[model samples]
Target: MTAYAVGQLRNVQMNDGIVDYLHGIDATLAPFGGRFIIHGGTRETLEGSPADDLIVIAFPSKAAARAWYVSPAYQVLVPLRLQGAEGDIYLMEGVGSEHRATDILDVG
Candidate 1:
């Protein structure tokens, strides 16, 4: 199943550290079959508070997503991201093709 790594960046510091992080991230992602589905694109907030920026990356599976996040190469760039931006990042599993609303609803 596919998995996603989503990040909601706030209070970004746009500096050399962030530039290095962007340049090196692709190489780290390639080995884990991760691809950027969305990277700092325009967004409209339909609801809730707005975020400064959003990033979404897709991976082959949940494990792959987790593995990539903790990989040695990615770890090297973590500090740069942290120093460049304040945000929340997380992994979420994707639903299968046959998924239905009832699959997640608990209406007993």
Candidate 2:
């Protein structure tokens, strides 16, 4: 199944560290079949608090996503991302085509 690395960012600090992180991220992603689906584009919040930015990257599978996140090349960039932004990052498993919301919910 496809998996995603989603980040909700705030308090972004644009600096040399972030520039280095941006420059090196693509190379790290290529080896794991990861691609950016969303990278801080425009957003509209329907409710609740809003984030400064949102990022989502898709990987072939959860394992691939995990591999990319922990790889040495990526690990080196981790501190830069943390220093540049305050946010939450999550690894989410995508649902298969056969999935149905009703199947997991009590419709009663």
Candidate 3:
């Protein structure tokens, strides 16, 4: 199944390290067939408190997504991100076309 890396980054420093990290991210993703689906632009808060930047990257599979995140190429850029922003990032499998809201009831 296709997987996604979803991140909600906040308190971004917007410094030179961040600039380099942004410029270098695509190259790190290329090896794992990962591509950005959302890169943060503008949004509306329907409820709850205001949100941070939303970033979603699609990968062929969970393993691919995990590999991409921990790969040496990406790891090299980690410090820059740590210096630039603080947030949560995670990977999740995508549902199939026939997936239904009640599917969760079937999970073990």
Structure candidate 3, residue pairs in collision: none
2 or 3, which is superior by TM-score? 3
Runs of candidate 1 exceeding 4 Å displacement: 106-108
Find the candidate with the highest lDDT and give its number. 3
Candidate 3 regions exceeding 4 Å error are none
Using all chains and alpha carbons, the TM-scores for the candidates as numbered come to: 0.90, 0.88, 0.94
How many clashing pairs per prediction, in order? Answer: 0, 0, 0
lDDT of 1 by residue, 1-108 (tens): 999999989989889989999999999999999999999766788989785688999999999999999999999999999888998999999999999988888666
Q: Global lDDT for candidate 2? A: 0.91
lDDT of 3 at 45: 82
- Which candidate would rank higher by TM-score, 1 or 2? 1
What's model 3's lDDT at 47?
Answer: 89
Worst 10 residues of 3 by lDDT: 42-51
Error of 2 at 86 (Å): 1.2
Clashes of 3: 0
